[model samples]
Each structure stands twice: as structure tokens, then as C-alpha cells.
Target: MVDKDATAAVSRSEEGDFVKSTWEVTVTSPEGVRHFPVYRTILKVPPVVLRLVQGELHFESALEVLHRREPVASGVLAVGETLRCGDWELSLHDRSGKSRAVLECFTDPFYSRIWTLHEQVTRVGRPGKRENELEIDHPTMSREHAVLSWEERGPVLRSSGRTWVDGVAAAETVLADGALVQMGDLLFQFRLLSELVLARGGLCVTSLGSFQARVHGELVTEKAWRTQAVRWMLARLALEWGRPVAVERLLDEFWPEMPEDKSRNNFNYTISTLRQVLGGSEAILRATGSLQLSPSFLGSHDLVALQRTLRVEDWGAAVELYGEYLPGCYLDWAVAMRGSLEQQVLQGGLRLLERYEASECWPEVLELGGKLHAIDSTCQRTALGVLRAHLGRGNASEGVRFYERFREHLGVELAMEPSAELAALAEQARGG
Candidate 1:
């Protein structure tokens, strides 16, 4: 059930709410050290109708006309009141309401672009001086990499170069209605929007990797949040999603430096602004002396997802989802939460390393070991796992080199010597 008003708002823009996207944020720590979060942006590219070459005409004619920028008869896109764009003859109701296609190219949580699949065979590859293909400006992309063709079943992708569908290498794969395609270093999602049902009304908040809040698939832009206080309030509540925190507790966490009377006034105003930005009173609920995000409005939070993955010992998924908690935020609550989650991810990485070692999966062990080591180089277990992985792969010289680095790092950083076990492993590597 998409919000009609929100969808209407989205339809009016070509790039959706990204015109005023949140790009970067800076926050100072309590100790006065300023932190700048890496650049990221939220994009809500709208879907467009997918049209084929009109009847009895060769596809080349349509292609030539489209290249010439001549207006064709792309129909009204009905996802939001039947909006029309370009001349591709696309509409939500076109082809029995299955004519919409969305190609979303995402580099990270912060950067993304969306394009409609209009051509019969959409060429994808590195940009050329005069080539008319979907040119991906990535170092890893080849000159003529792949082709995406519109078929009766759906969008079919074919590639001989490096290509992956849903993370598995594939030369040719018939893309599902919503398939994740990775070419070179960029990721793209192909979706037949008309064939998919809209999400049930809820607030989907993303805080890890990037910050975005979507209501029933409609993005809540930063402009809508007129105050930083309001954004902070929402983030705090989202951290405790569905759980109530005493109003006093929130006041203490957010404004411990201010006087109670002034803080309370600010808190009340922040809450009002938050509810309005989220679009209704039901977004936040008040009862007794506590505040909570209404459970019905909470959906697919990244932090919650990471916690669940950790609980189930899904180390790989947990590691993939882990990012700087509340980037650019040094607020007290955010700091505490960041430390707690970082420790969890660090521990999970160690466990995952041990699993990889046990299975003699040297590559996975090395990859995961490097990540854990970056987090905490002093962790003996991680260093040992990495050393063993290097040795297991028959790279004894590499193992010895890593050991030398680790031994020196430990002595200089912690004024400690490597344990006897680690020394013995290095000796074994030396002998080999």
C-alpha cells in the first residue's frame, strides 16, 4: 500500500528526492575531535514503463528515432498517476501492467542511479569516445562487456566478461523480476516494477552503510527533516526500534549538558518535528512517560538485521552488514552503540576466521582474517589465524613476513612479546 501523496511527490522529479540528497555530515566528539563521515547519498529513482518496438516496425527504426531524440509514443506511467516521459511508449498498464522496468546502479549505500530498460538489447560496458551503449565508467569494466535484452519472460542478461547475478558468476542468466546484477565493480538491480507488489505501509530505516528513511518505498528526504535535533531523535528511537525509552532517559542521553527545563522544551519540540517529518502522529507513540516508534511503522532496519545475524552466528552476513554505526555521529548514545556493535562484529569475525581455518579454506580464512586484523591488530587469535592461513596456502615466506610485522606491531604498540605458540609458528614458517 504505497502512500498516494508520497508517490505523487516522487513522480514529479526525474531523480526522485536525490536533488537535495544528504551527501556528508560532520560531528564533533565530546573530546572536541571532529569526525567526517564518508560521502554517501540517498536516491529514490522512480520506475519507468518498458516499451518494445511498435508493431510491424524493425527495432532499428525505433532505436534510430530514440537516438535522434525524436519523441515517440511512450504511454503514461501509472505507478504515480500515469506520468509520461520520453517517447518509449511505456505505461504501468502497458503489456497488461507488466511493462515497467527499473535498472538501479548502486556503488554503495550512498551512491545510486536508476535507468529504465527501454531498448530491446541494452549494451553495457566501459564508456567509449562515441559509443552509444550504457557506458559504465569503472576501471574494471571492459570495452564491450554485456548485453541486457528484453524477452517475453523478463529481462535476460548475457555476458562473457566478469559478470555476476546475485553474487554468483554467470555467463547468461534470465533475470528474475528483481535480480541483482554485478558488472565490473558496480551493482545493478533489474526490476519489473509493475509485476511486484508494493510494500505494506511502514517506515524502513537504513542507518548502517548509509542513512535513509523510506515510508512505504517513498523516500523521506533530508529537507523534510528541517532540524538536526529532529534527525537525532529519530535515530535514537530507531536504535531502540519498537522499544520505549523513558522521556527522561532520552533527555539525559541527548541533552545531558542542558538544564532540565530547557532540555524538556527542546525534546518536546523535537518529537513534534520528528512525527511531522515521518508524516503522521502514528510514526511515534507516546504513552505514560516513555516514547517508542510504532511497531507497525518499523521495517527492515539494518542495525536490527545485523543483530539478528549475529544471534544466529551468521558471521559472513553479519560482517557484510557491519559499518560505522551512525557515521559522523559522536553523540553519547551513538558512541556507546557503536562500541557495542563493533565488539560484536569483531568477535563474529574471529569466530568466522576459526571456522575457515578448521575447514582448511585458506582463501576465506585469509580474507576474513585481514578484515579482523584491520579492526584489532593486537588480537592474538586473529593474527594466529592469518598466519596459519598463509602457511596453509603454502606461502611460508608470506607467513613469516606477516609474523615479523605482527611481532613488531605488538612489541611497539603494547610493549609485549608474541606468545610462544605464535613464535613457534613463525619458526615453522622460517624452516619451510
Candidate 2:
């Protein structure tokens, strides 16, 4: 009864117990606004399925669900260069090409990827589309066998298909290729390997509690606060909302009555908590200001969308959407996603520089420059700050030269950490 013309079937027993991954990215290029479908393939020769225990997309890099590094291949990546990956494509490049922002994959694509959850760069698909991305775990070896009622389980790439994580059934639908999943409308599909499955698993399967504690950790250390009030607020937010929120916005929303000056200091205390958790070294917080959101923190998403919009502030919808109203712009969410100075530098510098360039007032440059410099000294522009640190003492010329280099790459200098060769060239440019 063998149907001829079909290739020799490899039985499930033959395919080896493992998984294969494919990345279906919808990129919004700087030039074109449409979300183009770009794909990357992730495959490892057999035995272990890409058992994503957990996965998250952070400012610096992508951390997997499992502790292992899964195989990944993408032209849009490089070492040390970190860019946000999700519903929209985002990346940074050195204008001067001195060195590109890193596209680092900590676990060599050759090894097994670990698991952890993070923001999904790619959005979920609409109903009725072939799985745009899927990892075939427990791959069937028998080529002849049809996928007989496969069990969808566990966490997958934010948008990957037919997965099983801790026996949870999580899935998204595509309209021939769409990303619209309505929980209320879903037909009890949550029987297994779904959101319900995860929720039900609770403390045992989900890391919500630990992640909250981590959020507080990020706040304290980075901001270096001197109080417990912010932590208390954070706990309340996590309890009320399902996630941690930005501290700044939290203050603005909840502490609306607090004086502005004190609010700033207290907000700082909140960020301080985050720092204590993540440590000050990892470049995890670059995008915190935007990552941390609350009822008032919607701006993070809006700000990002603005980056894609052709005409900013054009319509009533845009006005209402981008935090034009005060009540919707909370900052605690940023506190929740605390990361490193490198991350802050990338996020803040890009944002401020964009605002500064588009702005009518050049006077604000001083303030903007100060804030940018604080995150990544290179943004200090023409300030002597980076030079003092670079040369181990104050040196005006060195600082000037440093700025020249910084501007060449970042469009606006923060503070320079140029290599010896680049510094020499910078000095020459300054002299000229």
C-alpha cells in the first residue's frame, strides 16, 4: 500500500528526539514602512528538542527559555550589537562604520538553547495562517508518518508555532497570515499548552513572582535610592496589574499629588531597586524607560511606533495615542525593565537625538546632552567628561577629539571610548 513518488519516509523513531526552529520576522525597514517578512532558520543536529524552558527579548540580546543556546542564523545580527526584536524590527548602526552595534548570540547557534521569557519582538499572527514559525520538538523520524494530532505545548519563540512548554498550549492565528488572537473568543483551545495552562501551572511553571522581585532589584541598584517606599509601590503594582510597571510613571499616576521634585527623587529610588537586582554591568536596561510601562506608560509603545510613522503628530488618533494625555503616561514600567547603561545609552541617545534634531530649540541641547551623557558618556557631545575618563585625567584636547569620534558614529557624541587608532584620527580631525 506504499504510495509511490513520495520520498522514503523516515519514521519518528528515526528523526531523533530533537527540535528545529525557524524565525519569521516582520521587518519594518528605516526606508519602507511595511512589515516585510524576513526569515532565519535555527536547526541543531538531533536528540534534544529546542526545549525552550523560557525565553525573553531584552535590550541587549535574546535569552532563551532553556538555559542552553539554540542555533540561530540571521543576516541582521552581529557581535556586541544589541537591538530590540519583536513586533517591529529595530536596530542601530554606526553612521561612521567605526564599529557596528553588537548582534550577539551568547549561546553559539551550535549548542542547545535555554529558556526564559522576555518581550516578543515579533507580534502574534492572525487566525488561519500556516505556522509562520515552529519548532518541531520530539521530531518524528519516520518520514512516512503524518503529524497525527500533535500536542501543542510550552513556550515557543514569541511567535513560533505548535509548541509545548511545561505542557502549556500557547498559539496565535494568522489570516492567511494574521496575528489576531482573541482570548475571549478562543474556543477553549486552552485545553493544554496554552495561556491557561501556564496560568494554572502558576508558581511552579511561571516565573512571575521571581521576575517581580527582579524588577525591584533593577530599580534599587540602578537608581541607587535611599528608601523602601518605591519597593512597596512596586509590590502593589505587581499585585494589581499582572506585571511590574515603570517607576516614573507609577509616581505620576499614583503619586499625582507628590511634588515634582520629590517625585523625581523617589522615582530615582525606584530605579535604584532595579539596579540592585540586575547588577550594574549588564547592558540590560538600555530600553527600560520605554520597556517599563503602566496606565501612564503607554508612551513606550507609542514612542516606538512614532519611530515608524511617516508623519508624526498628524492626526487626532496619533495625538491621543502617544501620551498627549497625562493620565496614560506612566514611567514605572521602565523601572520594571531595568538594564545597563549601554542599553540606556542606545535607547535614550537615539530618542533624544531624534527629538533634538527635529526640535526648533537648540538650547535644550544642553539638557538633552547632559541626560544622554549620563547614560553613555559618549553622548556628552563636546563635553570634557569622556576625555577625563578615557585619559585617566582631564585633557581638553583629548575630550574634544573624543567627541568628534562619538558624533561620527552615533550622529551625536555621548562620550568617547574610541580605540587608540580612532582616537589618533579624531585628534587629527579636531586639529584640522
Candidate 3:
């Protein structure tokens, strides 16, 4: 039998905590206002509205806009409360009845970590030479957590009228199809294999070689542009993370010889073309801008930034920002990081590897394992790698040490491995 003791009405307001929009709060039940909930979002970039109940708050299902194979549901929301869902925290105020939420997006700490503000907007992609409205106040910036930026209050990001992070518009962004892709921390190339490469193309592939051949041909067939600009664009694509570009760089380096004037516009055209070419690729994020590819993009600066963040006890941000890169990169720095960062880095790095091995981050495995050996000589990379040549399988205790240098090092590995594994490996590595 349905009880007459409960009543719930939903209300929404664009104004956050500024004005409490009270709908008819009719207490018809003998229990008096037994149930009441409110929900809604003022922004439209990623259509989201949440449902709030009298006692508990949860993401209102009707507020979702992005359609995925598996839809991601927003988290629970309560009056004057914060809840983490994916990268954001949903909030509502009871007294003020304010309705607004924020996505606490995570990012790996960089050289300018003290400038959390810079890091926040760094992901927004660079601005053009012309005026950009993206610049805004960062009410979201939290100093206690060492957040850099203010709160990113910009028309470009659109917190009020519109926002991009929560919408299909962000997903609909037309990337160069073949340009490298970066979603959060995972960086890899996107290829057009069979047909599935482009949503419009409808192709998929099993063999990588065929896809590479097809995509490259289509991309290279650029018809209209000054040869220099086209060549420069290719240089940026061909070169990533300071990866080798002898193949294309050579062509671009000698482009002056390629009959020019067939194109119109000089400096302005080149600049505009460059902007269009790079698009949302975040090429400016490179360590620095140079005419040619800077060699420093090579290895593990992301690790450096992360290692420091862990030292400072910024675990939440560390995990959220560079969760994917942590396994391999953390091991190397964990040993060397000291003070608050060491313990935090060691634990978090191991936690990730314990869950994922196919992520196959070997540099850290080698570095941390080596550190262990230097301390006790009984440690092996058994947990991380195949114990194939487990020569140290028996006498783990007394072997000669191998690792020598690190960016920093307080001690070696055996001392660092977690208790259970340390004992087991020691018992086996030594004759215990």
C-alpha cells in the first residue's frame, strides 16, 4: 500500500545561492514535508541537470546530454554539498537553494605547479593572437590544495551561459583525424584503420600497417597553401614529444627550394595557416616554442612534475591528472622523492601497477627495482616483470648491487617494497 506520508516537488534556478526559488512546498502529509528535492543546471555546453531528494542528492538522469555507448551518470548532489563524479563535484545549497556544480579536473603538475591557475587553463588549448574571451576569474581555485589558477572564469570556457566539458560539442570538435590524441593523461596516435577511424568513414582495422598507409596518404594531399606553411604543419605533426622527424623535417628544412609564389599571403597567411593547422592539438604546450622541434620532449618530464606533487601529498590530483602515466614513471622517482612526497609516491605508484601490468611501464620498474637491490640486493623486479632469469630467485639477500644514480635517492629498494612482498622476495632471494 502506498503511504500518504511522503511528498516531493522539484525546482531549478540559474541563480546559484543568490536567490532561493521555492516552488509550492505543500506539507500535505501528516509527517510534514516528508519528501522534497530540487535539481537543474544553468549551463548548456554539456547538457546536465541533477535531481535532489529531501535527504540525499544524486545526479538527475534527465540532465544528461552526451550520448555514449555506456552513458556516464552524474553523482549525487545535496543542498550546500559537494560530490565527486568523474572529474567534477556537484553541489546545491539548502538554505540558499543555490544550484551549481564544478568539475575539479585533474592535471599532472608541471614546472609551473605553483601556478595552479596556469595548469588549469593549459588544458583549454592556447589562445589565438587575437582577443580570446577564455580568460576568467577562478572561483574554483583552492589554495589549501595548492591549486594554481583563479577558477578559469572565461567566456571561452563558458561556466554560466555554456560550458564545454559536459557536452557533445567537446566531443564533436573536429580533430585532424590523424593528429596525435590526448584525452586526460593518456597520449597516443589515432589512426584510420579499416573504416572506423573516422565516424563518418566507418572503417576498422586489425593490421596497423594498412591503416598508417591510408591515413598518411589522405593527410599529405593538402591542395592549397604556401609550401612553407604546409611543410611547417607537417613538421609539427611528424614531431611529437621531441620524437624523431628526420623523415619530414628534412623535407621542411629544405622547403625554400619548392617553387613558392603559387600561393597568396605571406606572414599573415603563414600565421593563420599555422593556427588552423595546429587547431586544438595543444602544440604550444611543448616545453618551449622554437622554429624546429625541441629535443627536450623526449622522456618523462611528466614524471618530474608528478614526482614532486606526490612529495607534497597531492595524491588526489596526482591520481586524477596522470593516473595512466604513474605506473612506469612513479617507480623511478618514488625512491628518490623524500619528505612527504616519497611515502606518497611509493604507495600510489605501487597501487597503480598492482592493478595494471599490461600498461607495461618498464622504466620505473627497472629504476625502483634497482634501488631495492642497492639497499638489500635481495629485491628483484619479479612482481613487475617475468621471473624468467630469476637467477636471484634463490639468494635474494647477498647479490651485488646494480643501480647507481637517480635524480634523487635517499635509500634502496628492499627497504621500500611493501611488507608482504618484501618478506617473500627476501625469503626466496636469500636462503631464508
Candidate 4:
């Protein structure tokens, strides 16, 4: 009876606690955008959110986060709206938004984030006592170092002082996707966003596994090509997609064994046939004694995608693009191209394997290692990688089987035994 007030206060404290709930937030950085789960508490801001916005994360800086168009802490979570903090932009969304978000994340770098012309011209350099869009804290940077502006071609970097584009000194240069720009001591990678909607659609040239062309997803058959000369000519042009091919080079490459006059006649006929096959004369551009596949018609090619993936170190995509390299095409030029592509595949695979192993991703290591070994059984590193992945996953029997098969294959194919390191791994798997 005497402590009635104290007892009521304790009871209210226990019953009035706030319930926490989890929500999905999409984080966008310079590298890409990814989603993260965040918790809501009635009493205070979430610690994780605070840390992310405070620039404690390894991959992002505050400028990238705050620069995102979507405001981060808008109280109500809108499905498509973005919220920014330090280096992360948290966009609220449901399950259906995942795929769209990922696609946006991939295409946005080239379409949305960098290309949204209305976002105003931004400056990059040392953050003065005040705020800036792209704050580079290095001493070499001035407070207002450079201005990034949207131009007719794309984004152009106008340097306030010393600046370099792709290692060349330039006061201003139009930027392309994947162009490296250096200002002061800090280096920035420029990604150009797509401006045009591609009304004419694009071409897909399948040169790796087979020779075929798909115009706007409709396959153009070999019969439609009319002749082998036309097919070869199309493949050659497709191989050197954006670059101009000299008429002389085309004659030599397409009909090298034929005489000059006959080759010239064949080249003209093949060009005419190809134009008909492509269904438009504008599909190929001729100017100043050089020919190139038109930018309007040439949209996406497998070889171009493969090279881009490799350049970006997207190893899994690179492996997928490296199908049967120019299979069934016995032309000397095709054979040479095939060899070059195969070498790139092997080298790219090895690099991928190294990265997977470093990250302790045993499953990916096994999968990529098996693929590499299938391509070239003589690859001792790939064989070892597969064996290690099996053992790492606690499948000793599978490791033993893989080693035995690899050893047998090596002996049969190259008349060689397993290397000492690989032999020791086999012994370890066998509990020797």
C-alpha cells in the first residue's frame, strides 16, 4: 500500500516498450547497388544505419550515398524512391522489386545515375570546410577541382587544374563507360549513361559457338546469307564491330586465295548480298575508303560482351560467353580468332579461380575449375583447384576420384604424371 506509486511506474515501463521491425533498403554505390535489411526502433536510430551513413563501410564513401537522387530518411518508405546516407542509398521495396532493382542497378550506371541530366552539373575535389558532390580528400585536390557536365556526346570532365583521361593529360574530354579519369592524386572511373533508346534495335553475332546473326531477337539463317563469302564477310565485320575495316583488308581476309580482280568482284557481290540479308543498306556504313558495322544496327555482340565482362573481371559471365570458340569455321582467320579467344578464356578462368579461392568460395572454385579442366585437361592448376575444393567441402572420396581421373586423363592426353604438389594433395585425400 505504501509503495503503490513505485509499483505502477515499474509496470508501465515493462508494458510500454517499443517493438522493432525489419525493412529492406536498397544500397547504391559507385560499384553497384545492393539491398540490405534494416531494423526500425521507436526509441532511437538503428546502429547499422548510422554506421553505413557515417562512412564506416569499406566499399562506399559519403559522397556516393548522399548524391543519390532518392532521399534516404523520408519517414515513409516508398517502393521506388531512394534514400541516401554516406556511401549507401537505401530504397524501400517489396519482394517483386528485387529483379527490377537489380536490373536498374546494372543498367542504371549506364542509364540512370550518371545520365540523369537534370541532376545538375557536379563538382569533384577536396571537400572544403563545406560539402561537395564528389569529395576527394587528397592534398593534391583543389576545393573545386573539376566539373562533370552532361554534354551532347555524354558526360564531359572539365578540369579546373591538372587532369588526365585514360593516362593522357586533357583539359576536357568526353567520357565513355569504363573510362578511367584522374584528377589530382585521386583516380575516378567514369561510366557513361545511355542517352538513346535504340529505336532501330541491335544485332547479336554468335561467332563463338557458331556463325549466326540475330536482328532484334529474330534469327537470320545461314540460307538467308545466300553464300559462304557473304557469311564470312559478315563474321569479319562483326568481329571488328565498332572499328572500321579497310576495303583492302576485307578483300585479303575474305578472299585472300583469289586474284585481285576476282576478289574485288566477289567482295562487291558479298557486300551487296550482306546488305540484302541484313534487310537494310544502312546496316553497314562506308566512308573514306573504310567500312564499319553501323552503330545504329550493331547493338550487342557476344565477342564484345565477353571482352567487356573479362575487362570488368566478371569471370562467371566470361566463362559463359566462351562457348565452342568459332566451332565448324575452318577459315584461317577464324581459326586464329578462335585460338586467341581460347587463350583469353583460359587466362580469365585462372584469374577467376584465384579470386574464388581467395574468398573461400569452394563451390564456385569447383564449378569453374571443372569447366577449365574440361576445356584443357592439361591445366594442372585447374585440376588441383577442383581437387582442393572437393577436399575442402569434406568430400574426400570425391577428391580422390577427381584426382585419379585427372591423373589418368593427363597420362593419356599428355603422357605426363601428376605434379609433385598435386600428388601430395592426392596422398592427403587418401589419408597417407
Best by TM-score: 4
Measured by TM-score, how close is model 3 to the native structure? 0.23
Pick out the ten consecutive residues of candidate 4 with the lowest summed lDDT: 100-109
Q: Give the per-residue lDDT of model 4 (tens digit) for 234-267.
A: 8888877645678998887777899899998888
Give residue 20's error in model 3 in angstroms. 19
Candidate 3, residue 189: Cα displacement in angstroms equals: 29
Candidate 4 Cα misplacement greater than 4 A, ranges: 1-202
The residue ranges of model 3 lying beyond 4 angstroms of the native Cα positions read 1-75, 79-90, 94-272, 275-348, 351-432
For model 2 the TM-score comes to 0.21
Q: Estimate each model's TM-score.
A: 0.51, 0.21, 0.23, 0.56
Summarize candidate 3's per-residue lDDT along 1-432 as a digit string, tens digits. 101111133332221111122211111233322112221111111123333333343343323322222345465433444333344333444423221212222122221111111122323322334332222223332112111132434212212222222212233232232333333331223222112112221111111011110121233224433454454343333223233233333333434355444222343355455444444223323211233222212112333444444543443334433422212222222223322343454455445433333454444444444433332233234332322123234323332121112201213533343345433543454453
Clashing pairs in 4: 62-86, 70-82, 71-83, 72-83, 72-84, 110-193
Query: Candidate 2 vs candidate 4: which has greater TM-score?
Result: 4
Candidate 4 lDDT at 54 equals 17
lDDT of each: 0.64, 0.30, 0.30, 0.61
Q: Rank the candidates by lDDT, best first.
A: 1, 4, 2, 3
Error of 4 at 337 (Å): 2.4
Model 1 off-target regions past 4 Å?
A: 1-198, 218-227, 408-417
Candidate 2: stretches off by over 4 Å: 1-336, 340-370, 378-418
